[model samples]
Target: MAYATLEALIKQYGLDAVLLVADRDQDGDIDADVVEDALTAATSEIDSYVGVKHRLPLPQVPDVLVRVCGDIALYRMSSEGGQLTEDKRQRYEDAVDYLKRVAAGTASLGLATPPEQETSGDAWFEAQPVRFGRLL
Candidate 1:
């Protein structure tokens, strides 16, 4: 589920801007599904890349993520116009890089709850290669 709403996107990015980017058909009104698809794609990409597994937008999302989601939304929208500007591409790249550090345990998620570890005990032993010399 996406943490940010369309209203938030509109408010943060400007309704006219968002509508302009999202209204593919130039029908004047922003397509709700287009907005949703971009949001979903952004969330999925970020969550997966950050090792958040499969969930997105997170329940109590962090501020960085919120902004990243917005950036990703805009990035995805830019696909329609062809050729993403370096600055725009860098915006999402920076956010993804930060998340990469978080996923690597080098950085933090700030106030949001961190992604839970799902490792079981004795993973090394469990992964030991089978011996072929002697049989019981």
Candidate 2:
């Protein structure tokens, strides 16, 4: 699943801003595919960094990641729409910087590490007592 949804993006950047950057056909509405593409790409990028520390496909989406993903996806859409602004660029950079910090263990996702599996180098076998044995 994508780290950020279109609703999350709209919540962060406003619906008009999303449409402005995502309406590639000039249809006066948000193109779901366009937004999904950006969000999917952003999610993959997030995984690359977050995977270094956390497991793939986190059990729950962090609020921080949702905001970061929104920023990254919005930056991507703006760049594709030829409307990239300094603020969008800076937000993208900041998101990536935070991801780097996460990868470097300088930042926290507040998720507990999964327990490691246990293994042993021993084996044993058991057998039922023979029923036909003669009494001593």
Candidate 3:
């Protein structure tokens, strides 16, 4: 993802505000320690700290997914700026569609699997070796 491009789009489209939904156990508070950890963990040059307008704490993974989907919908529907042009409109639509699928998947997983166990962050890191090949 191009952070500079995304930032430009946000400014051009007046999408200055964003609502970030994350699991309460992970990102409830914007503490310096948390920020530093995220910075250390980030694999891309794009700043991880950006795009957070308001942090909505969620107790469960399903709840977090639902809230994020809702937030994306709300942002797309907001009338604070002019109607989005074709390219921007398509981008927003694509993002919302992807998020919807993610939310559905998360909900299904939450239902099928025990809630007491969540995938570890290491699982994500381990997959990256085979998934992304190498970081640019």
RMSD of each: 8.7, 8.9, 16.3
lDDT by residue (tens digit), candidate 3, 1-136? 2112222323333333321211113343323332233223321211121212111222233433333333333234332233335654565465455444534443232334323234543432223346555678
- By summed lDDT, the worst window of 10 consecutive residues in model 2 runs over 113-122
Put the candidates in TM-score order, highest first.
2, 1, 3
Better of 1 and 2 by lDDT: 2
Q: Count the backbone clashes (under 3 Å) in each candidate.
A: 0, 0, 0
Better candidate by TM-score, 1 or 3: 1
lDDT of 2 at 50: 93
lDDT of 1 by residue, 55-99 (tens): 344556877777888888778887764636787788878878887
The per-residue C-alpha lDDT of model 1 at residue 76 equals: 85
Question: Per-prediction TM-score, please?
Answer: 0.71, 0.83, 0.26
Clashing pairs in 1: none
Model 3 has an lDDT value of 0.32
Candidate 2: clashing residue pairs, number: 0
